[model samples]
Target: MDVSQVLRMNGGDRDYSYSNNSFLQRKVISMTKPIIDDALANLYLDMNHPKNLIMADLGCSSGPNTLLVASELIKSIDKIRLKLGSDELPEIQFYLNDLPHNDFNTIFHYVSKFQKNLRNQMLSNSSPTCYVSGVPGSFYNRLFPRKSIHFVYSSYSLMWLSQVPEMVNTNKGNIYMSTTSPPSVIKAYHEQFQNDFFTFLKCRAEEVVSGGCMVLTILGRQSDDPCSKECCYVWDLLATSLNDMVSEGLIEEEKLDSFNIPQYTPSPKVSNEVEKEGSFVIDRLEVSEVNWDASTDHNLNLSGEHEQGYNMGKCMRAVAEPLVLSHFGESVIEEVFKRYTNNIKVSMSKEKTTLVNVTVSMTRKG
Candidate 1:
């Protein structure tokens, strides 16, 4: 599918833009903030007191969430400099990276505002010179110079494989790894994930300095089984939505059969295996559950389950619509998400649905 040319979050600041629908991502970033803070502190301890610090946020899609990790990083380092009684803060160079098709302009538009906000928060002398630039490319390949970055961070990314490995004709009416998928389909997905993840680590290893740190938060599976419900149910429901449309003659059945998402939720065991093969020391790897409706605020006393489902549907559409539109015709986008929203509401009414996210903290091997 030429994923790099086609894949991107829904752009601009509309209701369906990734910027508006990225509450779950924001929550994950917030949840991992303390861990990231500690990792940065340790990274500073390990760094040889450099005059400049380079940091990159890989898969940094546009929106308010794009600069979030970078902002927090600068704050963390600033705190460390203050504690050490340093007269000068290191020059901080922030690199935001994503696939070529990502909305870099949206991110660039906010850079000045981000810098101004930072200036307002810190003293003139204490404020480090922060240079922000966009690097548009895939992270699975080399994106930065060797030993150039001090800290690397990615959130709600890495689950997306470079592309869907081998078309699945055997698995009918399903779009992702499901229990109904054949053994070959499962094997293909696992192998693709291993290769992509290994390449990702290798590329970062070359870019990050010795003793530098990396923090990654990826959509993952709680169970070692590749077709675990925690990972596959969402796709299953999405497939169901497509099938419903097919039955209604809105979308062709053949179109549904040929489409599959280029995403894999690896188990922690898989992550450990890949880490061992890469040039990094795994400091911490943990899986946490994030509810589908985690982003919704119940305090507002909104229109109950349907509203929450609609919001969650928007979140999924923000991330998946572009891909779906590329495969299926654009005419079906609204109906697909409408059905998806109903499916989500129905599932939420029955029980809680959550996805497992894996957060890995690592240091470059010396």
Candidate 2:
């Protein structure tokens, strides 16, 4: 697979083959609200000088979802300031980062809208100045001023490596690796995922101020059994379905082997590696086994779900369209998506719909 063609959108999931945007937002808000609240309690941030804190939202996709999370964090900062009895709060430099292809115009517009609300609120003279900028490029590389950030947060982003792992290509069809899975492939990808992830931390360790905190919400599974695809079966299911299409001539075989999705999940090993790097210390590890109410009206779901649905489709096209067209001709993609959509609808027919789960880790590095 020519993985290079797959552009990483901000830092969100790369293999969302069955995504639905609205659904994803609701689910994410429900799941992360508490995590955000807890991070505030754990970090002891004060609003008296909220401006001194520089915070970032990595892989902040376009839409109300990113703003929703940002608003909660802003509120927490405000609450902390009110408690500190400060006449003037410090400015908060907000970095909204994502893949270069993300909807920055819309994000910029949203930030402007948020700013308007802040001004309209008649905030005290001490309210923090919010600085928003778009960091377009790979999170695998440095994304901001060194040692400038005070707190870093990423929701459902870190699980994806900069690109797909090399092992899947080398191992052919016999490999499945993620954060929590069989020890070997999990260990292999862990080694790789950690290497990339630790490099992220190490860079942040340099960029983050002393005593700074970082909170990340990532997808994960509970069992150690590597082959247990329960947590991250979406990709495997899509892959198998694609392979079947190839076998039956529903799609060309050449296109089948040439496509790879850039999505991944993290294991405890990711945290372990961060700690071993000697710059970051784990403060909390919380995993949520969230099950999608497949029965619920899909319209009520969250940004996470849309991402899942889209990657399962939107992103798949963005990444795989060229390969499919080049290998099987452009005329085949429409038919491909139609069948793909049908496959997803059919897969959701059970009484219960479940996903692997998400793991959130709160850490501090000095």
Candidate 3:
């Protein structure tokens, strides 16, 4: 599949759009605040308090959280400057990047408002202005000039592969890795992730200035086992719904078997790839758990009388609809996710909680 052309969060400002339903993603960003802080502090120290900071947030899906990462990073650096008793904050050039199909227009519309909010948050009156722009391309390919970026940021994005594994055809009856999947299926996912992540590090190594840092948060697993509960269980639960639809003649069985998510849940030990790529060193690696249904509104983005399952269903729809729509077509999407919501409720009843995320802070080797 041409993932760059089709895979995207639900675009536009509908109730089911990623913009409205991405509270969980926002929460992950907030959850890693200290790591961002640490990265910024180290950046200043390692780079000798540089006067200009050039940064990019890869896979910056549109929504409130779109600019939230940029705003928070700017604020963090300002505090770092103040703590170091600097007279002025560094000038910032921030680029927001994602695939061609990402809702760049939505974020473009919000930039002016984001600028206003950012100015209000700064404590220092200095000429260090921040410029924001959108760069549309696959990060899997090179997206920036060599040694130009001072910091690279990504959250909940690296888990997605550049493309579905070519060999996944053998993993019939599952959308992703599962307990029922053969070892060949697991091997295929592992190889794809290794290639993709190594490519990611190699490209960033060329683009980031020596000593610059990347603070990345990706959905991951702690166990080496591919079928670890926290790994692709959420996706497995989603696939269960599609399978049910297939059983009921609502969807074709062959259609469900042919589909595979272009995603991989890597363990923190993927630093092996970083070392092999050999341009960056891991500074801080931490794994944390956030509930699958962590939002304050269990009703999700819906208005009246919704529950946890309904909300999760909406949230997953926001993130996964585009991919599923590209695969199964729009005809059965509603019924599939409706069934997905029920599956989520059942999983929750059995104490299926938490999404495992790995946060790794790394610096380009000088």
Of models 2 and 3, which has the larger TM-score? 3
Q: Which candidate wins on TM-score?
A: 3
Q: Give one digit per residue, the lDDT tens place, for model 1 in 1-366.
A: 788887899999998999888888888888888879888888877774567898999999999999877788898788877777666778999999999889999999988899888877764356569999899899999999999899999998899999887854556878998998888888888889888998898888889899999999989987889899999988888899999989999989888888888999987785575556779888888888889897664445668543757788888889989989999978988889888878987887789899898888988889
- Per-candidate TM equals 0.95, 0.78, 0.96
The Cα RMSD in angstroms, rounded to one decimal, for candidate 1 relative to the true structure is 1.8
Candidate 3's residue-wise lDDT over 151-189, tens digit each?
999999999999998783477788999998888888898
Residue pairs with colliding backbones in model 1 are: none
Tell me the TM-score of model 2.
0.78
lDDT at position 59, candidate 1: 93
Root-mean-square deviation of candidate 3: 1.8
lDDT digits (tens) for residues 1-366 of candidate 2: 333334433223333221223344347556766667666655654322543667888877666566666666777766665676645555667888877766677667768788767655534544447778788766777888777776788876676667556543333432244333334445566566767877877777777766677778776666665445665565555556666677787765655554544455655555577667778777767766555443133555446544333333453353344444544566666766556554554565543446554544455544
- What lDDT does each candidate get? 0.86, 0.59, 0.87
Candidate 3 off by > 4 Å: 125-128, 296-304
